[model samples]
Target chain A: MKSDSDILTTIAVQFAIMSFLALGGANAVAPEIHRLTVEVHGWLTDRQFADMFAIAQAAPGPNVMIVTLIGFHVAGMWGAVVATLAMCGPTAVLALYLARTWDRFKDAQWRVAVQGGLVPISVGLIGASAIVLARAASHNWSAVAITAITAAFAYWTRWNPLWLICAAAVAGLAGLV
Target chain B: MPEPVSPPAPAAPIPSHAELFFAFFKITLSGFGGTLPWTRRMFVEEKRWMTDNEFNNVYALCQFLPGPNIVNLTTVFGSRMRGPTGAMAAWAGFLLLPFCMMIAVGLLYERYGDVDVARRLLSGIAPAAAGLIVATVAKMATPMFARFGPAPFVIVGTAFAIGVMRWPLLWVLAALVPVSIALTWWRRR
Candidate 1:
């Protein structure tokens, strides 16, 4: 009873904190989200997390929609709304304020170093996300094959990513994966 | 090279609040692969609101700030145009359609996500989605590895700590960011 409300509150608070730490984007925090939801709380499984990621990617929006789906999964409609807002709202307001002073420091040395520093960490966080998600998404030999082939094609070619997703879906429906 | 924010080249008309909203709404709808490129087109190409230089500067700023880079770009760009409320308008427009779409998708997933067919379909999509992320990381990393430095170690250390070690992220960043910045600062100096 009370625990339900507490859960939502926790979700809101944690997501708010995550927005600040989300260096590259929501993708950069994928590992962190996985840790909190699937590990710390046991609210979701690795499989469920991967599924939500797939659904969000399939939708035509920012990858941040994954947070919306997770919120909805945990606590229904209001949960969804709260998570999305928590994830986006505070950072947005912060961005509004920061934009004012940012232009003045456009070429500041500290700014350059900060950007340079965060760049590697951001890429690494994203890399961590890829590894964590790949482990979750791969369930069998065929699934591993799908991940490998998709990664190869996506890296080597310029075909639209949507096509790869579509092919993967068809293969799945056909029981090939 | 980084430059001061200046309205160089040709200046496009400053967008009204409504224009700001619609431009982003249209970009969200048009974006399939990703919104960033489409945003670049609309702001710099079609609308001419920003020169390429101006856009790049904003990109650098938004990327530096925490949270979603694209979402922050909308806020920063909007605020620049018409102050805070302008920021609200752009943010709302950018998120409105996607938010609705996600809710609807969420509802459907809640109902049917575990059904056998849907499960199979999702199982298929999941791995490929993960694959796409791998490819994305590769592309982002290739540029960094062009010259060997502490960056590769930073990347591997962070990845191992979080992805494998599953360390609490905030603590990891607290430790890593300052050291990483200092190294970069010394290098740049």
Candidate 2:
């Protein structure tokens, strides 16, 4: 019984830490979230993690909803509320304070340098997220083909990504990759 | 891009807390796929609450902060209009409906997640999700590498450490962010 409360507190703390480290956004922290929830805590499976991300992206609102879904999976309604707030609250407050004072440092050299340095780090973190998700999603050659083709279309074309998701679903239904 | 040395016009009329809240509420409801572009349209084109340049400036600040860029934008925009209360209203408006929807989806997934057909459908969706992330990274990476030097090194090193070696992310960032920042600072100097 006590373990249940401990788990909830842990979920809150974990996501709160993730909120600040999400330099490029929640997407940049996906790999870490996957590691903690799936690997360390045994909260969900790789399949479940992948599905939550897919559902979040396919949904009408923010992609950050994935965290909320994962929280729900872990600890019911309270978990959902705690995770959503933990993931967003600190960063929102920080942005509010920083936005007000940003103009004062707009022309500072150090500020520009920090932005320059952080950009690549952010991209790298996000790249790691992509790699982690790819490894989880594709285990067979046929699945690999789907990932490659979809990625090519996404990179080279301006087609809406939702179409690709739908097409993949149809392929799955048809017993094709 | 020089402007005449003239006093800036009076600040734009501030939105009421209700207006701030409902505007975000509407934005969240209509935001399919992504919210950033929709937010720009509402703030700049439709409402004229902020000019394009103003929107970009705020967006840049949000990007610099750690969090979902759009969520940060909501907080910044709301506070600009009405202070802390405004921030709460806007944040609630943006997240409340979507949070409920996600909960519903979570419930549905729990019930049907293991069904064979549902499993097949999710299997299809997962790879596509991976593809989308790859595309997003590819697009973001090009600009970082357009004038390459330390940027590629940081990107490759970080990626290799996390993705290949499976190192804990906290330690990797703790070690690398300082190095990357110092490199940029030195180069600029």
Candidate 3:
């Protein structure tokens, strides 16, 4: 077991790495994080890692919640606190700096180029995240059907998502999830 | 006859840094579930800090960066209004609140994650989580299609092909980036 200081140090380092390289969101760095957690730190097994990821995503709020959950698993309450703050704090500072300078080039050609370039990149990352989630969640035909129907209904109708979530919860309780 | 060159318009009296900070803080704290729709309502319909096109442009830029897109967009918007300090305040308010909540949940989860009810609750929630993702996709796509048309569709199609088909995302991006750039350049020309 790690001491509190060690855990805090680890949290700080991991948070910095994740914050800087979290391009496209937490999901974008997921494959690397999976490697670090399961392979390097041995904090959790691959199966446990996958399960926590599911729980984090299923829970309401930001995807960075995974960092806190994983830290809690590795250490304890302090780990969660350290990890969450570490993950959010430095990036918040950097975002502030970037925001300050953004106005100077409001009409620059490179600004338009960068903006146009990001559209496809975001689409690709979101698509990749969808596929990863599908593979993790859809273990059986029933689960597959749930996924498909959820996608279809959301794509087609104006139904509130809370209702669909409720339906799925009921389905899972019935051993269909 | 020679045309006269017009002088640039004077900048509007923008919000004070503190005002900008609080406005963004409010936006972040109140927005839950999917935030895009609420963000549109606030920025476009309510505060009118930016036009729809400007908001979309900033959003597009944020998406390419790492971290949460909404948080990043908040940084950009806050920065536009009040400079770096405002951006920091907005990001801190937005991320700090959510992080605290998530950490609380994580603590509870660590203590009681293996409980049967917890397991059952999570299992039930998984499908709902999937639905939320779909909801987010639709919410984003609507304004995208309405405003930009074929471009967004093309981006989606390319993404599906690369991600679902297991084609290399880098290669797909490589091919499309130039095409998108070329099209924009041609249109400008």
Candidate 4:
């Protein structure tokens, strides 16, 4: 079993890595996170990772819940605390420091370039995350169908996704997923 | 017809650090899964702490950095409102409650994850998650499309290239950034 210190160190290191690469959102680091959790740390399997991601989504808060879950897996309750704090702390500090000088360069050209440069990269990262999740979760034809249909509905319609989620839940209860 | 002239008024005073902390604390607790748009509504439109342009600019910067986007955003907004202290308060308030909830859920899951009912419940929730991701993509895309003709199209093309064509993400980004910058610059000129 992993020791408490080791777990805390892992959590801190993971968050530090995530803090740096989480460009765009939590999704941006999802692929890397998966690699670490499943491949490197041996903390969880790919399916378990996907399941935790689903839990994070179903929960009514930020996507950072995955950190909590992974932490719990590694070292129980305290691990959860360490992981969440470690994940959020650095970014908060960075944002604070950057905010101090943000106003002075509001109209700078590099700012515009940075903004322009990041949008596509963020989109690309999010898209990559989708592919990774789909690969992990799409174990059966039904799961694949659900993924494709959800993507289609979202892309084409304005229907609130809550209904689809409920429908999927019902289907899963009926052994559809 | 005589033009109506408005009387000159004093500018609003900057909010105090305490007030900024409380306001962000509320935003952090209240905001749920789809935080970006709601954050825009609160900070840019309702509170008027920052202009839409400012929010967009800051959001762009936050995106390139690490961690949860909203957490980064809260820090930036809080720091702007006060200083590092305000930023810490905001981060604490925003994170503390959610972290508690997630831990509780995690504990419960650890205990019962292998139970049949729990398995069924989790399976049921998976599709809902897929739907949520779709919704998020739509919500994020709509605003990007609303501004600058062809920008939306470019975003869509980029999404398709990345999503369906399996294009290398970096290469796609490499191609699109300059194209978007050139188009925006040319249009502005």
Candidate 5:
């Protein structure tokens, strides 16, 4: 059996790498994270991962809460703390440093070029995350329909998304999906 | 006739570190579905910590940085207001309560997650969550892709490689970023 420190170390290393690679945010890295924790490490089942993600979304605050849930599942409290810090620490430092200097370079040609290039990549990563989550969540036609309809509502309407989540829960409890 | 001059606006006070901490803590609590809107509301309208234009500029930079955009924003804003210590306060305030809450959730899941009712609820929620991600992508696409550019190509190519072919993300990005940047630079010239 692996030691507790080993598990924490693994969580730290993997999540730290993911911190930088998470180009579009936490959701963008969802597919890779699922691959690592669920498929590669066998720390969680696909259902468990999906459930955790749903729980994270249902909770208040930021989207990165899923990483905390995953870390907690994989290695308890320390795992959660380490994974969260690793995932957030490097980027926070970068932001701190950049906040000091970014504005000075705001109009620079290369800076503009970088921002222009990264936007599409970020969108693409988020799209990949949607595909990954849909694969895991939509096990049936009804579930697929729920996903599609919700996506439509979110795209075209200004209604609060929490209402859609609540409606879905009712549908599930009523055995519709 | 000359228009009357408007009265000077009140000078907003710089928030103390404690105030920064509590402000972010409260913001996290109120942010149910997403926190970005709340962030803007609190900083711009409620506290007047930043004007609309300043918030947008800072938000743009945060988006460009790696990791979660909101988390980066918290750091950037706090650092601007009160240096590193304030940054720590804001970050801690934003994260601590949520961390505790998630741990509670993890415990609850461990105890009762597999019960039929809970499973059913989760099953319902999962698809909705996935749909939110799709919606986010669509929301991001409209403003930029509406105009003619290399964005559509990069967005589609990146999605196909990662989502469909299941290629490694690192290699795909390594190949794409340089090409995308070069193309953008060339187009601009």
Candidate 6:
């Protein structure tokens, strides 16, 4: 395969910036990642993005691993490594430093405002991501039903989502969906 | 803030860097759905390393800070235990397994993803995955909506602009975050 250093650079730069934007965690930035990979660069199809998401969610670790999958698709294994490190590395450094003085100003009025302010926005961002993903995934009735049922379970019951994904997979294998 | 009173006395010996690594590594393996419960079990209950209150405080702090919440928890807990190296040790251990496994998953998907069985399975899983995200949003939004404040507006505006309008996230955030903050600050200040 011919090498494309540009793809790796793009992966690193975009994800590194989005690191801070991941306010409510990886899910919060999902829409942005979806935009960049699907809309901007056309690295992955909408179905591929949704499928990679399910794969990452089913696998252990952070929700951000979806970045790794995106990188894998774009630039192969190196893309995967660079994307994961770029997304994770800088933020890890920030956490290390903040762990020290954050406790000192725990009740600082400014800190409280900042935290409170970021919450609704991040929640909204995640909401946007859900919309984008649902649009991508729900093309047919079986898929639509699975999405609704899973959302119900997630919101109402505290059942582990792994089981929900499993049931859906079984349904697909049976060609039910 | 009353300086948080005195720090609680240590319950057990401080974890070494190796101990920190293994602890997180263990959590990763057992972290099927999510790691918070296992992390809490290991740090607070099993290891008796940090008290329940300490774990809660750390977790809240991690969430408030940027980055993946649990990943932040690993960094904060590791740094608190030993120092920078401890942080690195734990971070590495926490990520190592998942990184390898995800790579493997990616490779397999690339090689055989187009095969009928895999496509069918993924198509089934994809919608359910989308539902999971919807559920997550609902869970996050419910409390903000219940409060009957500027928060609901912010959440809705954000969702609308990005989700429906397909605006750029950076610009959307730049336009909204500060206004949201100013509203909150002005109200609370």
Every candidate's CA RMSD: 2.3, 2.8, 6.5, 5.5, 3.3, 2.7
Tell me the tens digit of each residue's lDDT in model 4 across A119-146. 7556656655676676677777888788
lDDT of 3 by residue, B73-180 (tens): 777777776677767766665566656666677667767877877666666665455545555555555666676533575557655654466454445556766776
Stretches of model 2 off by over 4 angstroms after superposition: B1-12
- Which rank order by DockQ, best down to worst? 1, 6, 5, 2, 4, 3
Better of 4 and 6 by TM-score: 6
DockQ of each: 0.80, 0.76, 0.34, 0.39, 0.79, 0.80
**In terms of TM-score, which candidate is stronger, 2 or 4?**
2
TM-score of predicted chain B versus true chain B for each candidate: 0.92, 0.90, 0.63, 0.61, 0.92, 0.92
User: Each prediction's Cα lDDT score?
Assistant: 0.88, 0.86, 0.64, 0.70, 0.87, 0.86
Instruction: For candidate 2, write residues A1-92 as lDDT tens digits.
Output: 55768978998999999888888898888888888999898899887888999898878777778999999999999999999999989999
TM-score of each: 0.95, 0.94, 0.72, 0.78, 0.96, 0.95
Q: lDDT per residue, candidate 5, A98-166, as tens digits? A: 888988998899988988888788898888888989988989999999999999998999988899899
Q: What is the lDDT of residue B102 in candidate 6?
A: 90
Q: What residue runs in model 1 are displaced by over 4 Å at the alpha carbon?
A: B1-11
Sorted on lDDT, best first, the list reads 1, 5, 6, 2, 4, 3
Candidate 1 local distance difference test against the native: 0.88
Q: For all candidates, what are the clash counts?
A: 0, 0, 3, 1, 0, 0
- Which parts of model 6 have CA positions greater than 4 angstroms off? A1-3, B1-10
The sequence of per-residue lDDT tens digits that candidate 2 reaches over residues B7-109 is: 2332457788888888888988888757888898887777777777777789877875788878989999988778999999999989988999999989999
Candidate 5 structure quality by residue, lDDT tens digits, B1-189: 234232233247989999999989998999888888998888887887877767777888888677988898998888878999999999988998889999999999999998989988988999999999999998998887798989888988888887877777778889998888888887887
Q: What fraction of the reference structure's interface contacts does model 1 contain?
A: 0.78
**What tens digits encode model 4's per-residue C-alpha lDDT throughout B1-189?**
133232233134556777666666666466554556667776665667776566766776676665688888888877766677767766776676777778888878888888887777677666557555655565666677677664666666665665666554446656876777676555555
Every prediction: chain A TM-score: 0.95, 0.95, 0.83, 0.94, 0.97, 0.94
* Local lDDT at A129 for model 3: 55
Best by TM-score: 5
Residue pairs clashing, model 1: none
